[model samples]
Target: MIDSFLTSYKIILASNSPRRKQFLTDLKIPFEVKTANIDEVYPDHLVKGEITDYLAKLKAAPLEKDLKDNQILITSDTIVWHNDTALGKPVNEAEAFSMLSNLSGTNHQVISSVCLTTKKQQLVESVTTEVTFKDLTPEEINYYIANYQPFDKAGAYGIQEWIGYIGITSIAGSYNNVVGLPTAKFYELLKKLV
Candidate 1:
């Protein structure tokens, strides 16, 4: 269904996330993964969606000059906003544990933004999902960390993994956003352009 919308254009997914790649593949959208190594740093003043939006747009920048008239490039970024701070990918076990501990028994916003660029148009949109986790004990967090090794994931957890199976009590918005990308919202955006 989605492929029909992009029949005339080549879709390029510019992200390293396996989940994001899988989501687009499951949608049966014909796209090729093309990633660029860019500094993920952003200004301190940017908050939540602003931060992700900026990064998503930034990820698209390097690909701008290479876009052909029939090629559309998609870039995205995800951040876990808890207690007014953004929790990015943990650098080590200690940091991951610290992040998980802070998220225990609390509600945090998972913000994901997607930027789409074509030769003639650019569009960016974001979705936020509020996720609530049950209070996780040290034993459980440790076990998950040891078993799953969520070092590459933001928020020190993956919603589709063991932690999500046992820890997440509820979510207020798109589940896919928590996983990584907001597929429904993204589909709507693509539909509009086609």
Candidate 2:
């Protein structure tokens, strides 16, 4: 099992996302959640995977220096990239509605980046998943926003939620990446550390 690959080290997950936490649990990679607040802001010039990669590493900045040699720190970031723009968490229902509306009947890329840090080394990787949504009606969008409250999710939607059940027409890559982490690719990267 994958846990055997991590037996030498304690794992630290640097994120508050319940979904990400559940992912590690599902993978049976024992880890404890720890988080520090940092401005989610990125430079204007960075695009797509570059943006998420930068943020994932940035999320590790405060935690990496404190890691023990036997502790591995994991940090991640996810963004919905549509029409050359990065869609992040919405601040309100109106913004959430707008984001989902833009995504209606169109394909967008969900980019997630994961960073692994040990006292002596660091590895970062980004994965992108293309998702297509059905043409969403206003009522459907309103219902999802009102009930799911996806203000915390990029693109104002969760691929595991009701919106996904009804709206997502197709997905071209790792579903876990769209959900926030890319477990298969991440498992491959972890092998490098072992």
**TM-score to native of every candidate shown:** 0.97, 0.98
Please provide, for model 2 over 1-194, each residue's C-alpha lDDT reduced to its tens digit, 9 standing for 90 to 100.
55676788899999989999999999888999888999999999999999999999999999888999899899999999999999999999999999999999999999999999999999999999999999999999999999999988999999999999999999999999999999987888788898
- Per-residue error at 132 for model 1, in Å? 0.5
Q: State residue 64's C-alpha deviation in candidate 2, in Å.
A: 0.7
Q: List the candidate 2 regions with Cα displacement exceeding 4 Å.
A: none
* Residue-by-residue lDDT tens digits, candidate 1, 1-194: 55666788899999878999999989888899898889999999999999999999999999888999989899989999999999999999999999999999999999999888898888899999999999999999999999999988889999999999999999999999999999998888887778
Assess each prediction's global lDDT (C-alpha) against the native. Answer: 0.93, 0.94
User: 68, model 1: CA deviation in Å?
Assistant: 0.2
